[model samples]
Target chain A: MDKIENNKAWFLVLPVFVIVAISAIIPLMTVVNYAFQDIFSPQDRYWVGTEWFESVLADDDLHGALIRQFVFSFVILLIEIPLGIALALAMPARGWRASLALVLMALPLLIPWNVVGTIWQVFARADIGLGGWLVNALGIPYNYTSDPVAAWLTIVVMDVWHWTPLVVLLCYAGLRAIPDAYYQAAAIDGATPWKVFRHIELPKMRGVLLIAVLLRFMDSFMIYTEPFVVTGGGPGNATTFLSIHLTKIAIGQMDLGPAAAISIIYFLIILTLSFVFYNVMTRMGTGERA
Target chain B: MSLQLQGIARTVGGSIHLHPVDALLEPGLHVLLGPTGAGKTSLMRLMAGLDAPSAGRILQDGQDVTGVPVRQRSVAFVYQQFINYPSLSVFENIASPLRLKGQERGAIERRVREVASLLHIDHLLDRLPAELSGGQQQRTAIARALAKDARLLLLDEPLVNLDYKLREELRTELRALFERRGAVVIYSTTEPIEALTMGGSVLVMHEGRVLQAGPTAQVYHHPASEAVAEVFSDPPMNLVNVEVTGGTARFPQGLELPLTGHLGMLEDGAYRFGIRALHLALRPKPGLPFLPARVELADISGSETFVHVHAEGLDWVVQEEGVHEHGLGEPVTVYLDPTRLYAFGPDGRVRAAPARGRGG
Candidate 1:
């Protein structure tokens, strides 16, 4: 059989290339351009050549925001992964109850980000809100508006409530895809419930668990709107994550050159972290034991 | 250990899956021979306590264990699909059951290696199930079951997923393995050759009912009904409808044979005559009754030949040893010794004595 070399097939991909260039490449190149130039006005721009990059890199506020972003992502991951798995395990395996549980678990994920933040803000208000009244009545001084620690706890709790459902849904799907034979075999082998979970359920959910971790990490790392809407990045910057800080530099302070440089660095950090995570997870998933 | 099923039945979604069944099984290899959907797996599940019977109780050692959970019972079930802990190496997979029992690590390793070597998989211990072939994965599953040393081992067509050569090899190994093990082993298969080769008691099942059960050779030679006969033959039992008037039964082609033995006692009416493929000889022998047939197709499978013939509106398969060629649409004469024939009444129940007799 002769191999067919059809160069005309490239014509079919031309539209995709055009769309990507317009939506992604051109905007990225504009950011790169802005990162190197100091603009006094629309027409009075000068080449700064690494000056903005150096200043952005040396900024202490950006460093604090970076560390806070890391801490937030790591903490959320630690809570959500195990909680999601437990929720999935406790869920019904069949019939109408399974369907009902899936729908209820998906409710938080379906709400818009701003709406979630608004809901939490009003719900956590110290005055006239049930949650605030109940917490204060319990004698734990609870006011997110003035206390940095309270504000930080509220944000973390809100984030978990909003995003842990995504992990639960993923892990649930992974759990459902396993054939019944494995469970039957385990039962026949006199396997305890914990052993069955450790040997069968957890291993089978590895792929989806990795996917959940990656998605939650990226989403939490780039988190902005919820905290902005709730605390306005306040309680004296207790929850001003990387996205909010970048926005403050670019839009609030009107420092485009340094903001663009900071944006580029932030993008690199996320890319490197995601790449490292993906490689490590895939290796563990397919690795052989000696 | 002794296992007994007392009127056990299963019904799923308002349809009967297994009719009420009663049987006592001792420790040995017992083949559940039936076609697919014959309630073999359902019955096995009830005995293993994986599923509760809708009607009756299951007893082990004369004690009722019907409502007991599978984990509490000393039983192991191997499904047709090869199932293993995919992330665990073969060693760990085999040791999982022992570890679950809280056995010491040293004893677990020793038993795992023993079963692995018994199943000829010792060298592949470190490889995960995903890295092994279909046969090796099933072997690992069986070895795991053997390592558990459960009192009752149920295998539901465990070799149906493997290639032919691998199935043959494992069948021999399993036959030997079950013979030595004290556990009550119940193996199910749709293939008659497997039942015959395993050499144990055979339970012939059809349409959710047990048609017959006895020693493998006895059941093969003396099936209790037409269903049992069909379930016990490979190319299937060739059944021809015949009319009986006096002391002789006449075939559709006007050939007559004397019904002088136990067949003589049956009422004169429409009866079905069944003969195994191997009993239908290709050449005419002296003193043997013969039937004329038109060859429709001849399938030669190396050592054996199956000749499909059409005669008097019925299709007949004749098995001949070695290579025998018959051209399509050719008229041929096939001989049948009347003593080896089976007589069934119009209701599909066997009438003649099961054992062979000298030609009269």
Candidate 2:
């Protein structure tokens, strides 16, 4: 077969490049510009170089927020991934029940993030909320507004309730994609149910689990609106994640240059972590299949 | 161990997949020969306890195990598609069954190596299933099944997915392997040559029913019904409708063939005369009846040749050894021994007769 050398294909890709530049690249460049310059007015901008970056990096508050952010993401992932896989395994394999379960699992994901925060905020109040009232009725001292532990627990539980469904849905799809022949062969081999899941289902779900991990990691690392609406980073900054801190720097105190620098650093952190995750996961998945 | 299926029937969604079937399978290689949608896989699955039968019971060594799940039964099945634990190496895949039974690691390794060597895949034990070819993957699956040491082994068209040359090689290897395993192995296939080469008891099935079951040679030489004969022959048994009158059967072309023995016992009426392609000689010999046919198509496959002839408004396939060229539309005379022919009564049942000498 003769190859068709067509330079005209370059013209087809030009529109996509232009759209990306207008939608993403241009805005990112503006942030990059803001990170390096101090602007007192529209025309009174002065170059600051790495001064704001150094300050943001040295700030103890920023360090604390970054640690808190890491802890939250790590804790949630440890809980959510296993819980989701177990839920997916327990779900119905077929029929109307499967359809209904899928819809119910997807309900939390469909709700707006801020709406989830608002709902939890009202639902966790000690005087009127069911959860808070029940806890108090059970003779436990639980007040999220005053106790740091209670606030952290409430935020983690709220995040789990709102996001664990995503992991469950992805794992469920992975489970369903496995062919029935594998299970049949395993059964005939006298494999126990745990052995079946460990050898067959877990290996087959590796690719989807990787995706779920990456998605949940990046999303949880950048979480803002829910915590911001619920606790507003209160209880002596116990739940003040990096995103909330960045927002407070950029809008609450109007420190644009340091906020821009922190934003760039946060983006780099996520990018580096995601790249590491993707490389490790793809290697593992391909290595097993290979 | 002896495995018996007692009046087993399988129905899915209110439609019958396999009607009630009862058969006693002894310890040896038994071939289940059938065409597609013949319920061969379903029957195998039921026997392996992978699926419960809608009716009847399964007995193993005179013990009822119909209610037992597949994992509790000492049975192993190899599917048409080569199924392996994709994440595991060939060694691990074979060792998995023993591991599931909580066997020690040393014993598991020994059994895995033994089965791998038997299947000639010991060198590929470290490789994953995806890295292996179709034939290698199936061999690995077979090795895994063998390592399990199940008393009853079920293989549903295990070689159907392999290439022609690989299929032939594996068929020979599998026949020997089954003999050494000392298990009651039930192998299903749609190919007649495979059933013949395996050389054991044969169960001929069609449309969810068992038409015939007996020794492989007995079924081949004497199919119980026209349906069984059709499924038992490669180009399908050449069945010609004949009218019998005065102890003689006459073809449509007015050729009167002498009816002897059991064929002569039938009252004068319409009957079906069946003959295998190999029994029809292209050349006429002494004491053999000849039929006039016109060559319609000649299909030469490797060393064997199949000549399709239109004889008296009926198409007949004649199998010939080696290559023999015959021009299309050429008039030819094919020889067939009357004693070797099978006669089917009006009800489609084979008319049983005393065994005759095997002829070329």
Candidate 3:
């Protein structure tokens, strides 16, 4: 009985564990190793204690970039969560109409992330883009290229357009997973539409919403491609988020030690925030920490 | 009309409309009895004011509630599913309606606890629906509807999801519960046993239309047609088409007998006739008349026995109370109680000449 119990089928997860450990753990260890060392060349390295971390902690550029990252994540969240729920509510519940609505909503999510950036890059241009022409025709000087506020607005709107579908799809699936009888019961209870949404739909969608928030927050925090492609950290660093600043220091200025410090700080920020997020999100479902 | 559904038929995606139901659903237990997909749910929703009936007006207490929204109608709908609120505890779910009506908190608490206790779910007061078993959840739903105090309760196969024994138990309890409340309950189910046992005047529906409606005994005794008779019993009512000629009804394959009473009223061509299993008996006596039959299958279930027999080439089930001593292939005599026999005309409607006895 003990032999039978211990006879685990190695085929079940042999390849998966190998891939994850090799790709994830080894790379993580390498990053950690690089975080606290002085590298003069690819072959030459020396231990520098917490010297890199100290410089990173003192860097004013890292601080500014950190603020920009949080602001973008918070703003994206504020715009997307409610908009996603609203879109989900508006979707048809049954028949071909529901399927068609779902397909349309999922279209944006299916597009490549970089393609989404490139499409919006052309789409948000002042001269040829529809939005630009509309604003210019309306007699407003709407040049996102030259204006920091316009650039930030463009980046936020582009991100919303590209990623709102993820939130909408998650919330829609959550809402659809609810049985029709629940709605019937609510109606029998004499709940108005608003009350039904608040008490039933809101509570039911909490788990999915929590997931959406965490996923979107992490993605927006590590946002690199879309804004990098669209704004190019332009309009005088107004749209230069954490990733852009890190890349500029590491690759542009070629400062290996301080840049390594900055990267370590960025990694720590992400790890800490993500841990907090997982705790908060996990608590939402059961109203208790596991 | 109390609850008017005039020319009510629904056609979806060019398929045939189930049928047009034009009848008044009166107050008290209106047990909608039919086979599955007889548009029972569609009819219940239309009656509950949850849905709009095509080409019809739903008049509730003589009001044109066809135009009124479900919320305005004050109708309570209890689905077959256990649909209690997952986020709310049992107490909260039961008290939600009272709070919505702006009832005082003390009164709401009193009523909620009373109903919860009445339903035997008091111990589960603080538990969410997600934590409860199916039966408990179903009881919670019933408790919630009871809290609404709706004049009409549209229970759409509400007890169907429970297991067999639990279903019967709940059915009796629900019947008593509804009776105590004096509520107009239009409880829909395709199961005839539910209609029969639940103390409701039966409304037999087939394909969305009301086939017949009366006290269970009356309807069972004089089922408007073969279809109506078929709708009343478990293992169902057995039919044997016969020829009635010159005050004589004869089973072409089995035996010929004198139809002394209503045989002269018989029409031409085939007469689709029915005799419920219980209505026909098989016992020997000195003077009593009997029909010769060959026992084809004597299915002796513990509660009841269904003796499938061939008499004069006509086949039917003879419902027996005690166990049948006869073997499956044995020859036996069936005593046909002509008074309990039902006859349908060539067109399958109940012969206006009348039937003698009830199935109850």
Interface RMSD of each: 3.1, 2.1, 3.5
The regions of model 2 sitting more than 4 angstroms off are A1-9, A39-46, B54-57, B102-105, B247-266, B277-341, B352-360
Q: Write the per-residue lDDT of candidate 1 for residues B1-360, one digit (tens) a residue.
A: 999999999999999999999999999999999999999998898989989899998999999998999888999888899899877899999998888889999999899999999999999999888789999999999999899999999999999999999999999999999999899999999999999999899999998998899999888877778888988899899999988888788897778988865577767888899988988888878888888889999999869999999998579999898998898999998888676778887778888854644321
Expressed as tens digits, the lDDT of each residue in B179-212 for candidate 3 is 7765678888877777888866888887656788
For candidate 3 chain B, the 10 contiguous residues with the lowest summed lDDT are B351-360
Separate clash counts for every candidate:
0, 0, 8
DockQ of each: 0.38, 0.43, 0.29
Per-residue CA lDDT of model 2 for B219-301, tens digit only, reads 88878889998998899988899988998888977788877865668778888888888888888689888888899999999
Model 3 interface RMSD over true interface Cα atoms: 3.5
TM for every model, in the order presented, reads 0.89, 0.87, 0.83
lDDT of 1: 0.90
The DockQ leader among the candidates is: 2
Which of the two candidates, 1 or 2, achieves a greater TM-score against the reference?
1
Docking class of 3: acceptable
Which pairs of residues clash in candidate 1, taking residues 3 or more apart in a chain or in different chains?
A: none
Q: Highest lDDT among the candidates is held by which one?
A: 2
Q: For residues A1-290, what per-residue lDDT tens digits would candidate 2 score against the true structure?
A: 99999999999999999999999999888889899999888799999999999999999999999999999999999999999999999999999999999999999999999999999898898989999889988999898889989999999999999999999999999999998999999878777788788888988899889999999999999999999998999888999999999999999999999999999999999999999988888777335541
